[model samples]
Target: DTAVSQTPKYLVTQMGNDKSIKCEQNLGHDTMYWYKQDSKKFLKIMFSYNNKELIINETVPNRFSPKSPDKAHLNLHINSLELGDSAVYFCASSQLKGTDLYEQYFGPGTRLTVT
Candidate 1:
């Protein structure tokens, strides 16, 4: 079974439109994160949820928000999308183990194209 899954692998929307991406993890991970990858493929953490609580809210735009209904699900909603928001958004989940602290399973990624 896939550990992490995201809906709408490819998203195409116009600027100023609001969109959302849903993510679910079946791995029973305590931590889940949303990341944005720019055109340069540089990944930056956006929001993180640990055990249904907001843990890390990085330096992201105010238009973006993350919502977690439970430990196994995290969703990202973007408002007033801009061309700059055109990039790949990734959802990842992990269980913190002393040895594999940074180990995470990522979804295939949602490609957002704003025009």
Candidate 2:
């Protein structure tokens, strides 16, 4: 079984449109995260939710929002999509082990294209 899954594996939308991507995890992890990988393959964490509480990364714009309905699910909402927003979005979950160590597992990823 897949530990993490994301809906709408591919999203193609026009600039200025709004879209949302849903993610679910069965790993029983306490922390979940949303990451964006640019065309250059540089991955950056957008947001993180620990037990359903939001922790936004400073570099992520306000146009992107992450909502966690529960510990097992985290959704991402993007308002006013732009060409720069085209990237692969990945959903990940992690469990904190002893002494600040963490092991994170990632979903297949959702590819978003903005035209």
Candidate 3:
């Protein structure tokens, strides 16, 4: 079974469009997160949820929102897409906080291109 998966690995569209990227994990993890990797390859956490509870990281934009229907699935919804939104989005999961390494297993990234 796939530990993590995302749909529409490549998305291209003009500015001001709304798009959503879906994600799912089967590792039985309680915590899931959405990360944005900019062109410079800097990984930034956009949002996280543990047991369907939202945990906001202050640095992220309010335009982005994450919805977790259950512990196994977390989805990202982006509004009014902009050129600055072009980047690779990665979905990841970990068993819980304070675990050793707590290494995030990432899915094949969804690349969003806004023109």
* TM-score of each candidate structure, all chains considered together: 0.95, 0.94, 0.93
* Candidate 1 lDDT tens digits, 5-113: 9998999999999999999999888899999999999999898898989989988999998999999999999999999999999999988667554898899999999
The lDDT values for all models are 0.93, 0.91, 0.89
User: What range of 10 consecutive residues in model 1 has the weakest lDDT sum?
Assistant: 95-104
* Tens-digit lDDT track of model 2 for 11-112: 999999999999999988878999999999999988889898876565888899889999999999999999999999999988755643257899999999
User: lDDT by residue for model 3 over 6-99, one digit each (tens)?
Assistant: 9889999899999999999998888888999999999988888989998755476678888999999999999999999999999999877586
**TM-score of candidate 3 against the unseen true structure:** 0.93
Give the count of colliding residue pairs in each prediction.
0, 0, 0
Q: What is the lDDT of residue 11 in candidate 3?
A: 95
Q: After superposition, how far is residue 74 of candidate 2 from its true place, in Å?
A: 0.4
